[model samples]
Target: MTTELLTPAEMADLVGVSVDTLRYYERERLISGVGRADNGHRRYDADDVAWIRVLRCLRDTGMTIDQLRHYCDLGEQGVTTKPERLAMLRDHRAKVEARRAEIDRALELIDHKIDIYLNEAAGDAP
Candidate 1:
C-alpha cells in the first residue's frame, strides 16, 4: 500500500483548518502519533487527516471540548471501545436532530412572516 503524508501547512490546507489548530490539537493531546521529518517538523499521514476531519465535524456541530476529549479518549482504546463510541455518537446525533427540529420551527415562522409581508404588499391581506 502506498503511504501518503503531509506537512503541517499541507495538512491544515487539506483539513481546512489552520496550522495553529493542528498544533493545538497535538499539544492538547486531542490527536497523537504524529511523525517527524528529518528536520523535526510535524508530518501528518492520511489517518491523521481523516481524524482531524472528524474532529472538525464534531466541533462544528457544537460538541463541547470535554465531550470531544472523552470521545477521543474512548477511540484511543481501539475496537473494544466501539460500543461506547457508538453510544456517544448516537447521543450526539439525537442532540443534532433536536437542534435541527428547532431550526425548522424558526424557519417555518420566518417563512410564514414572509408570506404575510408578500400578501400585504400585493393588497391580498384585508
Candidate 2:
C-alpha cells in the first residue's frame, strides 16, 4: 500500500499556491519533515497536503506568520501540545470573529451608501 507523491509543481497546483510559496513555507519552518525523492526534489504526500491546507486556512483567516511559526512549532512537538494549540486557535478565532464584526459594520455602511446612490440615480432621493 503506497500513496503517490506529488512534485512541487503538482503540489502547488493542488494546494492553490505557487512553488515559491511552498519553498518559502519550507524555508520559514512553517512546513517541516517534507520527504525528498531520489532526485532530492521535494515530494509531498497526502499528509503534507492536509497540513498545507491547514496552513492555508489559517493564513486565509489572518493568522500572522509569527503565529503560524509558533503553531508549527507546537505541531512538531506532537499530540502532547494539543491543549496549547487549542488555546492558541481559540484566541485566533476570537480575533477573526472580532474582525468579522468590524467587516460586517463596514459592509452595512457600504450597502447604505450604495442604496442612497441608487435612489439618487433613479430620482428617488429624499
Candidate 3:
C-alpha cells in the first residue's frame, strides 16, 4: 500500500509518540520542520516521516538531543562538514560500546542474583 502524506497526528501515530513530542522535536530543530497548509496546519510528507524514524532510532541508541542537533547542523552544512560528522559518529560509537559493556555487567549482576535466589530456594547455598 502507498503511504499517505501524514498530518502531525498521523505522523505521531506512525512514530508511536505524542503529537506534543513531535512538536518538541521540531522546536528543538532535531527533525525537519514540516510545511504548512493554507490554514497553517503542519503537513508532513513521507520524507519527514522517514526522518522521524531515523531520529527515533538514534534516540533509542542513546543519542542525546545535543548530539542530534549537532549532527543535524553538520548535515545542513553539506559536504564541508563531512570530516566533523565522521568524527562525531566515531565518538558516539565508542560511547555506545562503553554503555553496552555497562549493560552487560548489569545483566551479569542480575543473573548472579537470580542464581543466588534459586540456590536458596533449593536449600543449596552458593
Clashes of each: 0, 0, 0
Better of 1 and 2 by TM-score: 2
The residue ranges of model 3 lying beyond 4 angstroms of the native Cα positions read: 1-3, 124-126
Candidate topping TM-score = 2
lDDT at 111 for candidate 3?
Answer: 100
lDDT of 2 by residue, 1-126 (tens): 559899999999998999999999989999999999888999999999999999999999999889999999998899999999999999999998999999999999999999989889999655
lDDT (CA) for every model shown?
A: 0.88, 0.94, 0.88
- Per-candidate TM equals 0.86, 0.92, 0.86
Candidate topping lDDT: 2
RMSD of each: 2.3, 1.8, 2.6
Output candidate 3 Cα RMSD.
Answer: 2.6
| Candidate 1, poorest ten consecutive residues by summed lDDT | 21-30
Candidate 2: where is the Cα deviation over 4 Å? 124-126
